[model samples]
Target: MTRPVATKVAFEDGWKAADTITLDETARYRRRMVMTSDNGVEFLLDLGEARLLRHGDGLVLDDGRVIEVHAAPEKLYRVAAQDPHHMLRLAWHLGNRHCPSQIMEDCMLIRRDHTLRAMLEGLGAAVTEIEAAFDPEGGAYGESHGQHGHHHGHHHD
Candidate 1:
């Protein structure tokens, strides 16, 4: 039976659609959702069941669950991008998604983090230190050099 599709997402600060969202067809779910509105804001999103099937080019859920779409990945992506709660529920199920109350805490931590990381990078800490704050484990941290820290960067590595 198709489980009832309850609210899959709840924004911390009631974000306007089209701001921090993007769709992923082959991934079988919402790809990039910048979790802002709470406080500090971070670019991270939960993965939905839509991505749980083939287990190949799928989204590795925030819960550390790998879900690849074997059927209609694109349709599922539309469903997740249009609605946020269901996507958020996917995170809740993973046991990593934060609660409304914790939103503030997460924000505070993330903001301080970015600030410190920026400061560290500004102070000329090794590229590794800066990357650690933004992207740990030497993964694709991918930071675009910005002028005033706005999303837009004039120069990119």
Candidate 2:
């Protein structure tokens, strides 16, 4: 069996602005040591390679990833609590933020599918329900399943 290769989670500490590893406000952290090609972490989005256009009220990740939290509820509440107008915007994102996507609980690390489902299960949802909702063609994207393809299978909690 092939041994697991090492991976670089973040940029080396004490890295300078001029360092070859170029990351802007919305930066995409690539896994260097393991897979240099595939993106390891997607934190901030460097909008069209501009430096001055940095996100102000974003998260400076533990790994210095600089992920821009676009109206994340917890962060929004912290930053703009006093402002009624800004708070309204926060409420909007909370109500309409993508469902399948999971929000991070802490400021440390972001979680993917299985981990996210586990966290959601803690709240009051199931992985199978979410998966079925996203299934194309027959999914309950917006329309309820009619007298069409219906099936069931084993699922893990």
TM-scores, one per candidate: 0.16, 0.19
With candidate 1 superimposed using the best TM-score fit, by how many Å does residue 118's alpha carbon deviate from the native? 3.7
| 81-109: candidate 2 lDDT, tens digit per residue | 23455434433443353422222221111
TM-score for candidate 1, please give it: 0.16
Quantify all predictions' global Cα lDDT against the true fold: 0.25, 0.27
Q: Tens-digit lDDT track for model 1 on 5-81? A: 21234212322232222222223233344333122223344434222112122323333332222222121000111
Clashes of each: 14, 4
Relative to the unseen true structure, what is the C-alpha lDDT of residue 88 in candidate 2, on a scale of 0 to 100? 44
Candidate 1: how many backbone clashes? 14
- Which run of 10 residues does model 2 get worst, by summed lDDT? 70-79
Highest lDDT, which number? Answer: 2
